[model samples]
Target chain A: MSETAQRRGRGRRPAGEVREGVLRAAADLLLSEGIKAVTFDRVASAAGSSKMTLYKWWPSAGALAAEAYFAHSEHQLEFPDTGDIRADLTAQLRSFVRLLTHEGERTREGTGSVLAGLIGVAQTDPELSAAFSEHYSAPRRALAVAAFEKARDRGQLRAGIDLGILVDQLWGACYNRLLIPDAPLTEDYAVALVNNALDGAAAR
Target chain B: MSETAQRRGRGRRPAGEVREGVLRAAADLLLSEGIKAVTFDRVASAAGSSKMTLYKWWPSAGALAAEAYFAHSEHQLEFPDTGDIRADLTAQLRSFVRLLTHEGERTREGTGSVLAGLIGVAQTDPELSAAFSEHYSAPRRALAVAAFEKARDRGQLRAGIDLGILVDQLWGACYNRLLIPDAPLTEDYAVALVNNALDGAAAR
Candidate 1:
């Protein structure tokens, strides 16, 4: 639903503390043991709580994992919005690549392992899918869209190129690099992508 | 480990028939029940085998899940190389997008879910990475690179754009689309990507 709904529902003041603890434990389990290890029991044990406590809050392992990943990673990512469109976009992307390559190892796993599991879980479970769309997918997507819109406003993007598609192109490279063998997320590669996106490839 | 060595070690006989059986069971479980429902006992029971057999092959549940994913999805992908660089690349990319979007629904959980999870697994686990690379990532990468090379040979590309980085930018879009919540892959988007890669973005 809404951020307010997630922020304030069910219990009183201590709920926030309990939720944070649960998410932390889930993240820990995912990093140390991978996706399969983040069971309700494991999360409960790690959080020094019970399975009921987790289920009451998260509803499923995927939800718990998604929240934990966002909690851990969102802070690490700061979207730069300098007036200069090219410089700002490049800097933000470089930061993202560096984070993916270095600081955000577990976060990457959280997205891929736990969040992916949640998406798969959603395919079979309608309740999980709704939860995922609201809590995990939408917020992250909105941020990227907002960034592109800002870029367009600054006159960096061409008139016809779909912003959504452009975002996909930029992100595809990162995911491909991460998934492929011996694929390094290099500055040269990143620069080429940015340049290509800014100016279309029609032979001059 | 050489393919020859691996094959010779297995002695052209079923070295780990029971283990393979468990993996098959795990694959089935992953397909039917999603990643969350897969269990060691269930896999063993489904395969008409024992937990001991599974343990001998895979150390943990994630490991089992990862292997099951590789076994199921590794064979389904192929990167073709037609003489028409643009058309072949488009066809190949379209196939990949379809897999990521459609088969992704069916096999993603079993394949261990998420673009990031796949990458993380590939990084730490050499066998899994090699399998992922050989079967999925490398072949497509090589195909795309070759397509660009073919285009260059035919004088279709500009003089300065790095082919390696260009391929990454094009394929990167696909990866980014799947990794995040973006629009579904369409034929128009694929064409645009091919056109962009072949010719520099600057207008003629």
Candidate 2:
């Protein structure tokens, strides 16, 4: 009957829907522009919402960025289980490299521009840090752990070789490559990673 | 004395000396405050100099931080050539872990914090990334490579083992720990790295 009702009838959305829209906008910003460009104002404008709506959902920009980063990457780690350990590992490691290097180029851009800015902010903000650890690091870690466990179950891995260490080695290799851009994460290098870590190799 | 001489007496000293002072201050800031806090303004103030002086020495904060990080860790790696590969590797890996994890509680703090921050920055900055490769990553890689080389020479390592992957596995093990704060970089684990990489114990 009132203007609010009239606006609602004219395609206005509820507050919950507005929050999802804002989050989606933030994810788009992270993928396209990076974390630095995903501000509350920008997200609000892009989602046809207001700053108050964003503030109501996220306490800080870092929190919002963390959520956005997670949203962008949530569907990323669907590791397929092939019958062969070697084949599956090779494919998975290759995929990991691409995700960090080629496929996830935008996240890399955001790392320096927006993610770094958010991380700087996160260092002082415990809530954001916790959120980052939970959303970003945990999921990836779980995926790697699952991969290693599967490998072990297939009798492709050694009994004493720690799954935790193996997971770290796989992810750490990619992290190192991304962190150091000049060092190419080539196909040869990816092959070597699986051979040395998964299959095992001579020390020298 | 001329006005220039008067100014020199108060502020201007040998440019080299001033530059060294600024670098030293930058190192202290990097160690104390983490990488995000190492700004030209902070470095200049800490060094008791002007921003212009700091800028003249290092073009950017990343440059300054890289130089400072290397300066602090300038000790050339001592690769023990003991005939026993196992003993030699154990000693070397122990020292590596010590350097990486042993300063104080702050030792882990410094290495992990600075490395994570620098790697993130180096993702986009070509110059810094190169410098990081040359000064930081190269030396560590060289040490790992050399250790493998020594093993190969002694016939302790398998002939077909890939040095590139070998290096990644070793470093990746350490790095994985750094990224995952819950796990400890233990000496036994370090030994396991050498053993597993050298003679794979995969379930097969």
* Best-fitting candidate, scored by DockQ: 2
Candidate No. with top lDDT: 2
TM-scores, all candidates, are 0.68, 0.83
Q: State each model's TM-score restricted to chain B.
A: 0.67, 0.83
What DockQ do the predictions score, one after another? 0.28, 0.44
lDDT of 1 by residue, A125-179 (tens): 4555565567655665677778777766766555555566656556566556655
C-alpha DockQ for predicted model 1: 0.28
TM-score of chain A of each: 0.74, 0.78
lDDT score at residue B46, model 2, on the 0-100 scale: 91
Choose the strongest candidate by TM-score: 2
lDDT of 2 by residue, A65-167 (tens): 7887777653365677876677777787776665544444445432334444444445455556667777766676777677778777777776657777776
Error of 2 at A38 (Å): 2.9
